[model samples]
Target: MIQIGIVGVGTVGASVARILEENQDIITARAGKEIRVRKGVVRNLSRARDVAIPLTDDVDEILDDPDIDIVVELMGGVEEPYHVVKKALEKGKAVVTANKALLAYHRYELQDVAGDLPFEFEASVAGGIPIIKALREGLSANHIESIKGIINGTANYILTKMMTEGVDFGPVLKEAQALGYAEADPTFDIGGFDAAHKLLILASIAYGIDAKPEDILIEGIEQVTQEDIAFAKEFGYTIKLLGIAKKVGEFVELRVHPALVPQREMIAKVDGVMNGISVIGDKVGETMYYGPGAGGDATASAVISDIIAIARGGKSSPMLGFKRPLESGLQLLERDAIVSRYYLRLVVEDKPGVLAKVSQVMGEQKISIETMLQRPGEGETATLLLSTHRCEERAMQQALHALFGLESVKERPVMFRIER
Candidate 1:
């Protein structure tokens, strides 16, 4: 029998406890043992829960217990859970976690601490999507080329509404919050931090590059506007917040931000609150994985999948899918060195010299405009929406800075990368 101890019996944790009992016979058959939830740790024990398992306010009741074989840490955050997971590993207990933030900061350290013991986090990246296993085992033979994903449901939901119904971001965001899709403070989701955490986890597994959230470039969709949507429609494009990881020569570029994806692409068609990931491998070409990114039952399904894998004696594989360095020659590319096509929006004074000045600044930075549109705005302001052919991140930054300093420019410009 495999005894389970779940910390933070919140929505996902309660679902984990319930699913274990509901699917016991089949789970036992697949796991080759009777799986049971012995106890769970919660902050408030007085609050009623649906699971029948014993609950406690103290964490040591489960962590210190001798019979608990698997420790499932669903508690959110970095430092507290890191200590909990570290201690759980120190006690020689196999652990499974859904905490992406904890892994984003301390994955390499925990990987070293775990050594050979079974430590699984299939639920960390995309909920109910078996992406971790696919990257670690299924495509282990192929050299990973790139990973482009829409991993956050709340942001995807907002973007989809913006694209389909032509509604602005504010109304859609409020609707999403009312529908229970977004939190009261939606910065973590809409600001791209949630997807950034998941992207870091995948980047570590695929490239073995150790990087924190702060180490990479992360931008939100807060700047997207109706003018930008009109430009996307004119150019056969759709705006979506994307988490991108690409292998460029010896460097890996990791970034998360709103992007203008071609409307004909499969990823662009993935609308609503659905999550989709497109992974390109040198040997196998491109593959897509799509599903609900987060929900109590969906997330619990992934947590339980890890538990089953551990129960079946599947512990020999390395936690990050590599024994040593993934590729010693490959390193993390600097944020300023990234190269891609871009879409730029500038609200400026409606004057003839403004376009000439903007073009001159871009040319000075070695940026060439491919498409352009000018729409009259309120008063003397006009919206200039332009798409650049291709340019380095440094050059784009320099051009934006120069444009910002110009007297003709009214507001700070908005830009989104054009994913080709």
Candidate 2:
């Protein structure tokens, strides 16, 4: 029997305990042993939880128990979870976590600390999608070229509503929060940080890279207006917050931002609170994984899957699905180095020379406008919506800088990348 101790007993942890008990027979048969949750740790022991397992306020009881073979840290945080996981690994107990932020920063260090011990985190990325296992095992033979994903559900849900219902962001965000798709403080989910954390995990596995969240370019969906959604529809595109990682020779580019993806693409059709990831490899071409991105039962399913792997005595793979640790010498391509089509919205003075001034700045940067829209202003300013042909981000930045200096331009321009 494999005795398990779950710390946290919150939504995910409680779900893990329930699923293990409900599916005990099948899980045990598949795991080649009886997997049992001996104890669970929670802040308030008096608080009634759904799971039948004994709950305790003391974390040490589980950690100190000699019979507990595996310690599941569902606790969500950086420092305390880090210390708990570190201590659990030190005690020779196998560790499983769903904390992406903690792992994103300290994965390599934790991997070193755990050494030969099993340290599994299948649930850390996309909720129930086994993208991590697929990359680590199924596509093990191929060299990962790039990974593009709609990893966060809150942003996707908001964008979907904005596009389909023609609603603005604020109302949709409120609706999402009411539907339990978003948090009270939705910054972590809507700001692209959540997706960025997941992307860092995938990047490390695919490229052997240990890049931090601060090292990558991250843009949120706060600026995606209803007009932008309408423009995307007119151009046959869908707007989504995407976590993108691409390898160019030795250099790897990493970013999380709202993108205008082709309408026909599978990822573009993934709506509501769902997740999808498209991974390109040398041999596999392009492969996609899609499923529910978050929820108690869905995420818990993934955590239990990792537990079953441990119960079956699966060993950690040394290659870790990459050739070696990503060399620091391998340049991380800056956002400015990226080349893509762009969507630009500018509020300008409704004057004849205004267009000429904007065009001149773009001309100096050699950026060609592919499509343009002009709407008469409610007041003294008009809205100019323009799409540009493939251009370097650096050139676009330069063009925007020069355009801002123009006397005809009213406000800072809103720009979004067009993903082909």
Candidate 3:
């Protein structure tokens, strides 16, 4: 029998215990042995929980227990979970975690500490999608070219509502919160930090690049407006917040932001709370993985899969699925040097020379406009919605700065990348 100790017996933890108990016979047959949840650790022991396992307020009760063979750390945070997982590894316990933030910051260090120990984190990236296993093992034969994904369900939900119903950001966000899809603060999910953490995890497996959330460009869907949605519809495009990672020569580009994806693309069809990842490999071309990104049951399904792998004697070769750097001399591309097509929305005074002035500023920065649209705004203001040909981010940003100085320009221009 494999004895398991789960820390943070909250939503996912409770689901893990329930699944183990309810599906004991099948789980035992698949794992080749019976897996049991011996105990659970929680911050408040007084709160009633659904699971029948022994619950304790102290973490050491599970961490220090001799009979426990595996430690499941579902607790959410950076420092505390890191220390706990490190101690679990030091104690020679196999660890499975769903903590993406912890991995984003200390994955390399944990890989060092968990040498040869069966440490698994399939639940960290995209809930039950199993993209981790695909990148680390299934697609190991090919060179990973790029990964584009809609990994965060909260942002996807809001964007889908905005596009379908033509509602604004504020009302949709409130509805998402009321539906339990978003938190009260919502910054972590809506601000793209949640997807950024997941991207860092995937980047490590595919490229062996050790980068934190701060190292990449992360922009949320909060800036997406109804006007942007209308423009997307008009141009046969759909707006989605995308986490993108691509290998460009010797450098890898990682970014998370709202994108104007062509409507015909498969990824653009992934709407509502569903998560989808499109991985392009040099040998296999492109493959898509789709599923529910998060929930108690969905995430628990991933956590339990890791347990089954460990049960089948899957040794921990390397946490990031590499013994050494997969691709050396490949540095992370600087954000300012990124090149992509862009969509810009600006409010300008309703005058003939406004468009000319805007075009001149873009021309000075070496940016050429691709498509343009003008709409009547409140009073003497007019909205100028335009898409630009591919250009360097630095040049486009400079042009935007120059446009701000123009007297005809009104508010700061909203921008989204156009993905072909």
**What is candidate 3's lDDT per residue for 72-133, written digit by digit as tens?**
99999999999999999899899999999999999999999999999999999889999999
Rank by lDDT, highest first: 3, 1, 2
> Could you tell me which residue pairs clash in candidate 3?
none
CA displacement after TM-score superposition, residue 71 of candidate 2 (Å)? 0.9
Give the Cα-based TM-score of candidate 2 against the true structure. 0.97
**Clashes per candidate (backbone, < 3 Å):** 0, 0, 0
lDDT values of the candidates?
A: 0.93, 0.90, 0.94
Q: Deviation in angstroms for 401 in model 2?
A: 2.3
Superior candidate under TM-score, 1 versus 2: 1
Q: What is the lDDT of residue 108 in candidate 3?
A: 93
Q: Where does the lowest 10-residue lDDT sum fall in candidate 3?
A: 321-330
| Candidate 2 per-residue lDDT over residues 317-338, each given as its tens digit | 6524543564544667777888
Superposition error at 338 for model 1 (Å): 0.2
State the lDDT of candidate 1 residue by residue for 1-420, as single tens digits: 999999999999999998999999899999999999999999997898888999998889988999999999999999999999999999999999999999999999999899999999999988999999999999999889999999999999999999889899999999999999999999999999999999999998889888999999999999888889999999899999999999998899999999999999999988888999999999999999999999999999999999999999876489998988854567889999999999999999997788899999999999999999999999999999999988999999999999999999989888889998
